[model samples]
Target: SQTIHQWPATLVQPVGSPLSLECTVEGTSNPNLYWYRQAAGRGLQLLFYSVGIGQISSEVPQNLSASRPQDRQFILSSKKLLLSDSGFYLCAWTAENYGYTFGSGTRLTVV
Candidate 1:
């Protein structure tokens, strides 16, 4: 079975601080990885996606960035976090629309 893991589960950061969130998958190979941000009014936004290592695509331009340096590892990073960046961050993987398995998710609260 395949599974995804994300942490630190929840986060509280001040505006203009740095941010880093890690996600990894188990039991799958070469899966397409995606990073999504769920804001209150904005709905779900695709921040980045990677079909393979070193191949990242950004769907929206904001304070978020994503990287896939390993086949099963994905990371979301921000040098300067914003209050608007506060929301739910999710990592998901898909096998051609068969479906996406999301991580536990991170509730980021920025002030």
Candidate 2:
């Protein structure tokens, strides 16, 4: 009964505005967590990942940062969002013998 919760489902923000997206997993422990961004019709780009609490790895350099303060909680944040930062954000988690399970995702639009 593992599940990932992500929000908000959609957002429209002005450029230079701060942003925060959160994801949390239930019924799992020490899962490999990830943040991915998918531009319109583009492939999924890995943003950040964590194998354990307080251990975050950035896959690409961008205005965004990620943190895993708890074993099942992951947060994505941006101090000032850029126009190019708009996209579909997904949070996913996987464990040994389990394929990745993604949350519903957040569609962001930077105006």
Candidate 3:
């Protein structure tokens, strides 16, 4: 069975700190990876997507970045955190003919 894992489930950071979140998928090969953010009441926003290793597409220009180190691992990082960067971060993967499988998200709060 394929599964996606994302962590740490929650975080609270001071302003200007660094941030790193990780996600990995198992039981699948070469899946399309994605990062999304959901605010308190807003809709889900697509932050990044990767079709293959080292191929990342970012949809927004917020203070965040993503990387794909291997076929099944995706990482999200930030050099410095901002107060507005607080939100729920989600990692998901999908392949042809299959719906997206999402991991447990990370809720980040910067103060």
Every model: Cα RMSD to truth: 1.4, 0.8, 0.9
Q: Give the candidate number with the greatest TM-score.
A: 2
Candidate 1 yields a Cα-based lDDT of: 0.91
- Which lDDT values do the candidates have, in the order given? 0.91, 0.96, 0.94
User: Deviation in angstroms for 37 in model 1?
Assistant: 0.7
Instruction: Give residue 100's lDDT in candidate 1 (0 to 100).
Output: 85
lDDT score at residue 87, model 3, on the 0-100 scale: 96
Task: Show the lowest summed lDDT stretch of 10 residues, model 3.
Answer: 93-102
RMSD of 1: 1.4
Candidate 3 residue lDDT tens string, 1-111: 888999999999999999999999999899999999999888899999999999999998989999999999999999999999999999999856778889999999999
lDDT digits (tens) for residues 1-111 of candidate 1? 888899989999999999999999999899899999898766788889999999999997888888898999999999999889999999999955579889989999999
- Deviation of model 1 at 6, angstroms: 0.9
Best prediction by lDDT: 2
Off by over 4 Å in 1: none
Ranking by TM-score: 2, 3, 1
